[model samples]
Target: MSDSSFRILIIGVLIACSLTHVRSDASDHRYKVGDVVPLYANKVGPFHNPSETYRYFDLPFCSPDGIIKEKREALGEVLNGDRLVSAPYKLNFRDEKDSAVACRKKLSEQDVAQFRSAVEKDFYFQMYYDDLPIWGFIGKVDKEGKTHPNEYKYFLYKHIQFDILYNKDRVIEISARMDPHSLVDLTEDKEVDVEFMYSVKWKETDTPFEKRMEKYSLSSSLPHHLEIHWFSIINSCVTVLLLTGFLATILMRVLKNDFVKYAQDEEAADDQEETGWKYIHGDVFRFPKYKSLFAAALGSGSQLFTLTVFIFMLALVGVFYPYNRGALFTALVVIYALTSGIAGYTAASFYCQLEGTNWVRNLLLTGCLFCGPLFLTFCFLNTVAIAYNATAALPFGTIVVIVLIWTLVTSPLLVLGGIAGKNSKAEFQAPCRTTKYPREIPPLPWYRSAIPQMAMAGFLPFSAIYIELYYIFASVWGHRIYTIYSILFIVFIILLIVTAFITVALTYFQLAAEDHEWWWRSFLCGGSTGAFIYAYCLYYYYARSDMSGFMQTSFFFGYMACICYGFFLMLGTVGFRASLLFVRHIYRSIKCE
Candidate 1:
């Protein structure tokens, strides 16, 4: 096809996709009644203001079969993606009295007799249709009835049922209609029982109830619109590219001059030699303090780096999304567990190279440094969530499962990695041998210090990714679906490149200034981006989002902190490796005898 024709065809495809995403009623996609469809309740307070305090709590009482069709706005067709469970409850549509009695039996005697609150509260039901949650208020309830004292009366919900017609393939037609009169009422005990009297047959028509049901699907997925911020991405990329080019040009020019000067000086008649990075080659590679700890961090960071890369690749390929619920979380947990071996191996190898003898201590520190803090933070946050009756809180069983995964899968792999790492015979090769004692480090100005270098290094990497970070935060906190994995993967690569380049530049400058303590500084310089990310998250929560309640606050900050820490480790490792290579290459270039 010609370029214009291709463009037109692409646009046509996008429009078609946005208009309708047809899916077959296959076993996996098809939902049945009484199959335990997940229901999320959004509780509203006085004046029906949505209490954005707690996350949706699962209501296991009613199994609702609904279709959550997400509109592919770019393509103009709706795609059927599953974000939530969509099985329906098998309600034996019998007499009202019998249905009520059956529902009453499902609840405890105390629950059936007692009321929750005196004032009526608005609880919205988030029905998972096609695995997408379409939230709507079902009914109103008052603990103390306005007319009857100590008695509660629940209002009934009346919504139109979407009758979707398909030719023979079970694919939904664009002209779908909503047949009015599907009713359900909440009893005094908060039990859900459908009103069989209000049920109706499939009413096929060209148009029913004002607009087509497809409009509702479009609106439902509106929040999750694929917003490709092209300008922001381009701006970020250009800025980072410019900065990278400048740093590379300066480093190359300066290094070339230094190499020429050193070579000329060495061949001169003068006995005295100049002092710089070359002069301290022996002490530069000397074992840093807390060697064991450093090795462990490096190992874990490496593992995390690999894990992130793999996950992003999978996401980009569409293997883990648009269908599976909780797949990402499950994948992360599993992958991280598997990568524990990598962590242990890298840490142990580095420690052994540093001539560390206490293997047990090294191993323990490697495992505890990140994981311990993570678990503790999660526990504290979970406790707070539980206390506040938040649905965001992880259940006891889930916690147990996570713990078991770590213990059985991760722990054993870590041990195996440690053993393998220890058994390896690789030598810690340095260009120059270290002296008996450490060199006396000279004092430098504030700008030349490690802290300042780290701050500068971190800012560059953060700047490269800050724009993408906003979208990530929105998707996580705003109940929006982000499907731009290709763009995200590109941005991720850019972030890595920027991080490595800046770290190398900063490390070289620091070393040139006679600062032999570049080991930890290099790591910190790259890792400090996490600090910036965390700071951004705080700003996002307070300034951008209208999120309230202790649970939401805790969950956001708590998980964000953990994520930032991982970011730190990953970037820090990148920085350290780049600097290490730079140091080795420069040292080897000089005639250091």
Candidate 2:
């Protein structure tokens, strides 16, 4: 063909392809009512407090498509017994006929007994599709009331119906509707029947999940809270900047004067005399007494720091698309196991630097300090969940998987990292040699003491993230969805900066008070922010939140303790590194003889 003819032909082909693409996009597949869809239970929560939620098993119902019908789990399957019984659901279309309901399987005496036990424990079921909760129910059935054993009181859903639409053999659409009765009195056991009624119809929609979410999931003001708190966040930023500026100015003036004094002629320098931190320069650089403990903490802190950064970055970048707590938790566990090398290296290197010889002991203790506590706590929590038959309890297979991750992935990485760190040399260099005997620390005033300094230093770092904490708390406890990774990232950075600066300032104050024992103080000062965070959590639980179940309460406080401990490690590491740099710079600048 000629060039002009070929070009014309190409244009025609391109046009046809574009048209086909548009048509394909516009005519996506449609779903029918009888076709069973996967019903995900993202997390189960108490009625009063949705924020405190736990992951549970999903439920599958039988539905028919054009060609096939999906089968439900076996009646004997004990999956999510708290929310649903294992008995098969026999469908009925009639609403008024008791015989039709009676045709369906009635709860056996054993089933009734188990169900009654679950209801007494306040167990409820909430169904979620896509990332939103669609249906919620409590096992409220008519049973003998405690007030009057002779009379029966209704407890569960008084009216339950499923609206289904089918076209010939294919089921096209489905939705659930229910009118729940007053809270059931479960104090007494009375055998009861469970039944479901259905109404059939047909409707088509482009976005089923979105439509369902709108109809079922109650809208919350969590986003509004995020927007409203922007001013307070900005205020916190400004306050942190001012405080850092003041601290920087004071340190600069003091250090500059010290440098000038030390730079003087021999006679003049002698007359001025090295005082405060300068007086104990030889002892300040001395390895702390609990070298093994220090090394272990530093290693764990480094690992947690990296994990925090990685998680925030992933969230900010939308890697955690659904942004559910379960996903976040899984990612953390996997990442932490992978990052064990970093933790091992940090601890081993620091321990070696302190001229300690117990490499194996240090590595073992390091792993135990953080990971051991976490594992123990997890086991305890899991036991509690199992006792309550809470879905949050991990299955045996999942527990095995976690153990394998720790033993195979984390443990090996720790050993490799410890070996590497032991082999490598640390860059830290002290201008003055450590003295054999420790310098006698002078008596300090109340304000200059370690407790006062730690208490005061922690507040600034906490303040930096206080505004953001509201949203974080809501996401964890309330039905609020957290998606602003950018905001979280910014807050994390601010927290780091505040922690470092405040810790340095506190260290300076302690040293100036003629205290040479700054090794632990620096870590404590920054790590203490976790204490404040825990305090705020208590305040939120008692004063700001509506959470009421003992299970939720236990879970919240239990997990919060672990979270705060990790926070302590991260912040403490930042502070210690900052203080170390600050001390090194001051000594190096001064001609310490």
Candidate 3:
């Protein structure tokens, strides 16, 4: 195919994929009175640990038929541990069903034991009908909701009442409630005949289809800490504003005075020795060691930065919502793959700017910088999930699909971007030229060392987001649903501003100390925030959360490592970009001869 045709085909494919996602849910279809409505049973897991889920049929539940049929789901759904399968409940649009026995089974001793165990762990089952999710407990503890194995009575919820609300012909909301009276006591060890019963009720409502998900957010069983989230956001904003104020003062007053003094000294032809940042102007722009790695990091960071902003923007516009299973993950994967070109262009352009050859090597490094680690981690996690028979495990087909996307879509775009970047004529716009011979650096105090500077620089940015991080952790690891994208976006912007200002301030200090090797140090100083975030993850795992087991622990830390690594790159790039601009402005204002 011609280049333009290939590009057009790729664009068309992407648009088709996006449109498919938008209309993936069954609710998007307009149904007549007798249209068949399918109900899909998702995963079931302990209420306390959200990440550890298994297929709904893992337990000894009565199947609709001897052979089970699985429903095809989106990539996001699979990643989020959703194993959607056809349920036995049969209903048509606008059709109401009285109490009906959906399935019947004679429970054996093993079956009773399974139910007992599930009830003991407080397992919850998730189901979807008309693209609306419904959740209910598998069983209940009878002793005043306490899980005392010796005293509390365990009962299986054998009957379910699906209350579905509709606006005209469109389903607006769905809720599942267990019939308390129909609970079957699992205290006995003997075999029993259990009849799984269900009733469907369709009611008319004024709520529109677009607003169907609002009920889930408002009436969620999980705790809503809106006030706490707002407080944290406000606190972070104040911290950022103060830091910005300090930075503005330095730029406006201190830097202005330094510029005036330097210009005056140049006019006087003073032979006095120069001090502070002014003394290191010649070496500040020197290309650092490991040019390939540095350029790759910047490129990956640029892609990640763009991905984050776009994800948040989509969430703000309601393209993703709490009830939409796997939507966020799906978006993340697709966007990351599509934005691979940004990374290639940035890495290539920056490498070219530094007068580095071996462009192919640089491009390869940029492509693998983040993805290599992520792929390895994912492989390990997938292996663990497979071992444990967890629903989080991706099927072989899904893995093949993802690999194809990376190989075909991501690799090609990255190469194209690299080609474009290499052909560009723009050069590195450094205000000062580097000296032929390197200058000898003076010894600094222990407190002024790179390590200390990184710690100090990283802590401020970490502090600004730790409170918000708690909420995010809860949503990801616990049962809470995160819906306040606006607050999250605000916190995200605050984090970037704080990171940039703090890194710039520290870079200024490093330069004043006559440290010409600020390239890697500045990057490390900003990236150190990821280290702090990982530390906080440890603290949260131990102190705040009750998540346990090898699978959950491994998954949590493994994925968190990837997330923090991305943060390190993205924020480090921000710091480097800001510091580069700051250095150029300061050097450019003076008469450098």
Candidate closest to the true structure, highest TM-score: 3
lDDT of 2 by residue, 326-438 (tens): 44555566667767778888899989989989989999998998877777877887777787666566667666777887898789888988998898877458878888898
- Model 1 spans > 4 angstroms off: 1-123, 129-132, 138-228
Tell me how many clashing residue pairs each candidate has.
Answer: 23, 15, 0
Clashing pairs in 3: none
Whole-model lDDT for model 2 versus the true structure? 0.65
Number of clashing residue pairs, candidate 1: 23
TM-score of each: 0.74, 0.77, 0.93
Badly placed stretches (over 4 Å) of model 2 are: 1-34, 40-45, 49-123, 128-132, 139-153, 158-176, 180-194, 199-223, 265-272
The true-versus-predicted C-alpha distance at residue 562 of model 2, in Å, is 1.2
Model 3 lowest lDDT segment of ten: 15-24
